[model samples]
Target: MGDASRPRFMGAALAGEAGSSRPSLESGHHSYPSFDNNSSVYALNPEHGGTESRTGSQYFNYRDDPNDVPMQPLGDSRYLDEKRATYAAPRQRSRAKMILAGVAAGVIALIIIVVVAVYFGVVKKNDNDKSTNNDSASKPSGTSGSGGKGSSSNLVVTGGDGSKVTTDNGTTFTYQNSFGGYWYWDPNDPFNNGAKAQSWTPALNETFNWGVDKIYGVNLGGWLVTEPFIVPSLYEKYPKAVDEWTLSEAMAADTANGGLSQLEDHYKTFITEEDFAQIAGAGLNFVRIPLPYWAIETRGDEPYLAKVCWTYFLKAIRWARKYGIRINLDLHSLPGSQNEWNHSGRMNDVNFLNGPMGIANAQRSLDYIRIIAEFISQDQYKDVVVMFGITNEPEEAIFGLDNLQRYYLQAYNNVRLASGIGEGKGPMISYHDAFLPLTQWAGFMSGADRIMLDDHPYICFGGQSAAPISSYATTPCKTWGANMNTSMSAFGMTAAGEFSNAVTDCGKWLNGVGLGARYDGTFAGSTAVGDCDTWTNWPAWDDTMKSGIKQFALASMDALQNWFFWTWKIGNSTETGKVESPAWSYQLGLQNGWMPTDPRQAAGVCGNTAPWDPPLAPSATGGSGAGQIPASVSNSLHWPPTTISNVGGGATDLPTYTPTGAVPTLSAETFSSASGTGTINAGNGWANSKDTAGAMVAIATCSYLDPWVGQGIAPPSPLCSGGARRRDVPLPLITPPPSPS
Candidate 1:
C-alpha cells in the first residue's frame, strides 16, 4: 500500500476542470508514466538515473556501470517529496525497465480518478437541471401554483388507479372512485322549477350518463343595486365632501342635488322587464341580482335609500320568472360597511359583520336575511329564486375568519328556520370564498345541507403583470380549467358568481382618475396601454382575439358548475362616456359576435357531456308574480322631499305615489357600422335596438356608452339623423346564433 520505495515516471496527463492532478513519488511535479509493451519484467525508475528491482517481497539494487552504488534500505520514513532520494543511476537499460513499470501504475490510477470526476461533475449536475425544469412546469408565472391566489398548501394530483403523484410544490392528489353517474331533473324536487324536466324518462338501454351541466348566468349589477364602476355618472353627478362614502351618501346627495324624482326615474329605466326578456332571448338562463340590505329595510332618516325599490325589486323577480330565468338573490351590500370596499356601498371601514360594531351589524343583516328568505321561499318564488347569498365578498383578513364563520352559521341557521324548507330540499345557500384558496372550503357546509362556494375570478383588477389582450383572456382560464373538478369536488355546488370578458383597466372613472376611456376603438385586439396619458388611436377588437377569447370562455363554461358574467348591461353614456362599455357588457359582446350566442351549446361544442337542454323550452312571458306592492312610497322614504324640512316620517306632509314620471328624453344619434349589425334606428331612438345582433354592436347611450359615433371609424356626420326619433324601423326578431360547428 506504501509508495515510498516506488520509482517515479513522466507522461502527458493534464488537470481536469476541478483542478485534479496525479502526484509523482519523486520530484514535486507529478505526471503519468508511459507504458511500453516490449518488456515482461518490471523495474522501478527514479526521476534521477537509477534502477531498483522487485523480486518476491523485497526490493533489490544492482549496478551496470562501475560508479553506480547500492540503494538505501526501504523503510517507512516520513520524508516529504521536496526531500531528494539518495540514489544514482545504475545504467540506461535498468532505467528503461523502471519507466515501463511506473507508466503502467500511473495509467491505472488516472482511469479511476477520471471516472469519478465525470460522474459528480457532469452526470449529477445534469440530474439537478432536470429537477429545476419540473418546478417551472407546475408553478406558472404570476400564479400561486400551489392551488390559487394566497394559497399555502401544494396541489395534490392522484392517478386514476391506486397511485399518487405529488407536485414539486407539495400539492397532493389522491385517486377518487368515479361516480359514473349524472343528475336528472326530478319532478318531485321542489327546487327543480320544472324548467329542465323531460316528459319521459330515458330508456334503460341508453349507455351514456350525462355529467353535471354548466350553468350560464349574468349578474344584474348596477341594476337593483348600483356600483360606482357600473355607473360613474352617479359619482360625478352627486359630489360629496369626501367624494362618495357609501350608497347612503350618494342617495342623500342625489335626492338633494338632482331630486329624489330623478333618482327614481333612474331606477325605473336603468333595468326593466325588457332587460330580462332580452337576457333570456340571448340564451342565458340565470341572473344573480345583487341588492343592498337597505333595499328592503328603511333607515329612519335616509330618504334616498330604498324609497321605491321594494316595488322594483318585486318587478325584477316577476320579470325573471316571466323570462324563464332563475334568480340568485345576492344581498350584496350589508349594513354598516362590509370589509371596507366601495362595492359594499362604502369604503375604508370593516363595520358590517366584522369589527367592533360587527355583531350588531351582523344581527341586523341576519334579520333582513330572514325576511328576504321567508319572502323568496313563498310558494310563488321558491322555485324561481334558486339561490340566496348571505353576503358578497367579505374581507376576512381584516375581519377574522372565526368571526365570519360564526356570522355565517348564525345567518345559515336563521335562513333555514325562516325558509322552513330545511337544507337540500330548497334553494342552495351561497358563500363567498373570502379570497381563500378554493380547496380551503371543501366540506365547508357538511352533513345534510346543500351550499355553493362562490368565487369571483377576475384578472382585470390589481397590479398583476399586464399581458397581451388575448393572454388576459386565455391564460388564467386555462389554468383554472385544468384544476376545476378536483377543487370543486367537496362543495355541494359552486359557481363563478362574478366574472367579466374585460381585458383592460382603461375606464378611468372605474378607479376614479384617468382619461374618460382606456382603449379608443375596441377591445377585441387592443394591447396594453402604451402611454398612460394617450387615450385614443387603439385598434378595434378584431376577429382573431375574439375567437381566442370565445374558445377560452367555452372552456371556462365547462370547468365550473355555473358562471355569471359581471354585468348584463352598462348604460350608454354621453358625457365623458361611450354608448357601449365593452369590458362590462354581455349584450355588447353578443351583439358584437364575440360572446357565444348560447352557453348550452358549449357542452356540444366541447364534446364533454350534454348541458341542461330542455325539450320544450320554458316560456319567456308567463309566470306567477310576487302578489303585493309597497303601501306608501313617501312613508318608506322616511325623509321629506326637498321642499319640506321634516326629518322623520310625518303622515300629514307625505307625498302620494305618482308615476316615476316619463323616462328622461335625451337626444342621441343612431349607431351603425359597416363592421356591426348597423344601429337599428327605430323612431324611439337607439333604445329599441338592443335586441339587434352584429359583429360589433354599440347603440344605447347613458353614462357608459359613447354617443353619436358612426359605427366604423369616425363620429357621425352633421347631417346624420339627430334628436329623439320615433320607432320607424321594424323590430328585428333577435335570435340566438346557431351552435358552433
Candidate 2:
C-alpha cells in the first residue's frame, strides 16, 4: 500500500511529446507478496493505499464513451465564467433607519416611496436588461443559434436522433438519474397536433410468477423540476456553507418572476420521447425514473409535492407508451444524494449514508416516496413499471448485519403503508455491502414479498478487490466468504427475487498478456504488433473483430444468456474496477506499474500483457496499455459542457480540445475493421451493421430496458447475503485459435 509500489513517473504514450513526471509502479515501494497459485487470498487491498478517488467521491470525471472513463481532463476552464448571473440590485435606503430620522410623517412616507421606486427599478432593470447581458454571456461559448446570447435554460440535450453517440473507440462514461426521461415529444407538437400524442397504456404486467421475465429498468436523473437550483445562486455551497438557503429564500424576490419558465425549460430538456425510443429500441423494456423529494415540496404554503410528481408521472407514462418503453418510477435522492453521487446529484465528495444530515435526508426521502406511491399507483399508470427503492445504496448498516435488516424492514413497511401498494406489489430494493463478509451478511438480510438483493461490487477505490472468478467458492476474502449459490440458498435468494451487479465496463478488465487479435481474426496479437503497450492501440474493430467475434459471441452467449451482469456498462463514475489502484497493477494515475493497458480506460479491450502482478508488473510488457487508453488521451473528449470546468482545476489547467458542436467521430479505419464474415449472429455476440442473415445485429443498449413492475416498496426477499458464496462458474477452456492452415 505504500506509494513506493507505484512508479514516480507515468509512462504516458503522448502522440509526439516526450517524458513527463508520472508515478512508477515499483518506485520506493513495499514489494507485494507473490500470490500463491493455490489461492492464499491475494493481499493487495485498495483501502489502505495512496488512493485519490475520495471516500464517496471528490472529483467528477469527464469523458467521451460511457465506460470506466479516466478522470475527465480539466476540459475548458471557462465553465466558472458562467457563474450565477445575478442582477446588482438598485441602491435603496434602509426603511428602519429612514423612519427613525425624526422627520415629518409625510417625509417618512416620501422616503418609503423613494425606496419602493428604487426596489422596483432594480427588479425591472434585471428583467429588461437581462436580454442584452444574457445574450452575450450565453453566446460566449458558442452553440448558440442567434448572434444574441442563448439562455442557459434552452441549452439542454435536445430531442434529436443521437444514435451516433459512438463512432469510435471507447476511451470512456456515470450518474445523474434523469427522472426526466420520455418528455421530448410535445404532447401537442405541431407535427402531431390532434394525434393524442400523449395517450399511452399504464397497465404493468403484475403476474408475479417467480423466475418469469421480470421487467427491468434503470434511473436517469431528471433535473427539470430542480434545474433552477442548478444556478449555484439557489444553493448554499454544499458541505461547508455557513447556512443553507431554501428554494424560496434563494428565489424569493427577483429570481421568482421567471421561475416558471426556468422550471418548464428544465423539464423540457430533462427528457425526450426520442431518447425513450432509443432506449426502448436498445432492448431495455423498462425505465425507473427517479424524482427527488424536493420536487414534491414547494417552498410556499402550497406544499403538496405529491401532486407535482403525479403531473410529471402521467406525462412520462404517455411518452413511454409512444416509444414502447415501460416505466418504473425510482426515488434516487433522499433529502440528499443517495448511493454516492453517481446520479443522486448531491456532491459525491462525502459519505451520505450515515452522516447525520444523510439520516434526515433519508426520512424525507421515505416521506416523498409515500407521497408518490399514494396517489400515482391508484391512477391509470398503475401497471406501469413502477417501484420504490427504499433508499439507493444505504450503507449505514452495511458493516452490521442486524442494522442492515432493520433499516430495510423500516424501509419496507414505510413504502408499503404509505403507497397502499399493500402485500403483493413488493418493491425491489438494493443495499450496499460493508467490506466485511458478504456471504455471512447476505443471510442476515433475506427478503420476502418481491425483495431483491442489490450488491454493488466495486474494485476501484476502497471497494471490493478482484480475485479469480473461481475464488468465489474457495476464498474467505471474496463475496459472502463461501460459495455464491449456497449463500444465496441460505438467504432464500432464488429465481425471481434474483440478484444483480454492475460489472466492469466492457474493456476495463481484459488484461491478458501473450496474444494479439483484431476485428478480422488477423494475426494482430502477434508480438510483431509491438509489445503490450502497443496493444492499447488495438483498433476498436480489431478487438472483437478477431475471428469474426467468435470470442465475443462465445462470451455474450455465455454471460448475457445467464442471470448475472445486472448492468452491462459503467462510465467513470461507477468506481467498481481497479484502474488507478496501486494496490492493483500499479497505483494512482497508473504512475508506475507497466503500462500494459487500463482496462477501465478502454472497457473491453483485452490486453495481452504478462500476468498482472500487484504493486506493479515484473517486467515492462510491450503490451502495456496496448489496447487500453491513457489519461492523456482520455483527457480529451468533453461531453456535457460542464466537463470543461471539471478539468483545469477551475481555470489555470484548462484543456484545449474545443468540442466543436460537431459530434466526435471515429476513424473509418476503426469502423471498417470486422471480425465477422458478414453474418448476423447474436450467438457470437457480434451483430451485423445491417441486420444481414448470418451476422448478429448491433442493437441500442437501452433497447433492452423495460418498465412494467408496479410494486410498492418491497422487502428484501430471502437474502443472498453477499454473492461471495455464489459458486464461481468455472472458466471453460477457450477453443484455441485454429492451428495455422
Model 2: number of backbone collisions: 151
lDDT of 1 by residue, 1-741 (tens): 111111111111111112122111121222223221101011111222322222233221111111221222322121222233475743333576778877777788777765554334433332343235321112211212111233222212111223242322345433221211111111111121212111111111111111233356898887756655566566456544111233445555554555445556677778866576557556576789887776655443433355356557666654554334667889887765564445665544445433223333554566567656655654445556768888987755444455566567656655655444232323567898765546656655454244567877643332222344444332332234423444444444567888665443445344331222223322222334443222111136577766755765654565443688878877654465653345567876777776777564444232323222221111100112211113342133222111111112221221111111121111222223222323422122111222122111111220111211111222123211333221112233343321111
RMSD of 1: 36.6
* Model 2 lDDT, residue 444, Cα: 42
Question: Would you list the C-alpha lDDT of every candidate in the order shown?
Answer: 0.43, 0.27
TM-score for each model: 0.51, 0.37
Q: Taking the candidates one at a time, how many backbone clashes does each contain?
A: 33, 151
Most accurate candidate by lDDT: 1
lDDT of 2 by residue, 100-194 (tens): 55456667777787555433442223233334431111211112221112223222211222312211133111111122222122111101101
What candidate 1 gets wrong by more than 4 Å, as runs, is 1-213, 239-258, 300-304, 421-424, 464-466, 512-539, 577-580, 604-741
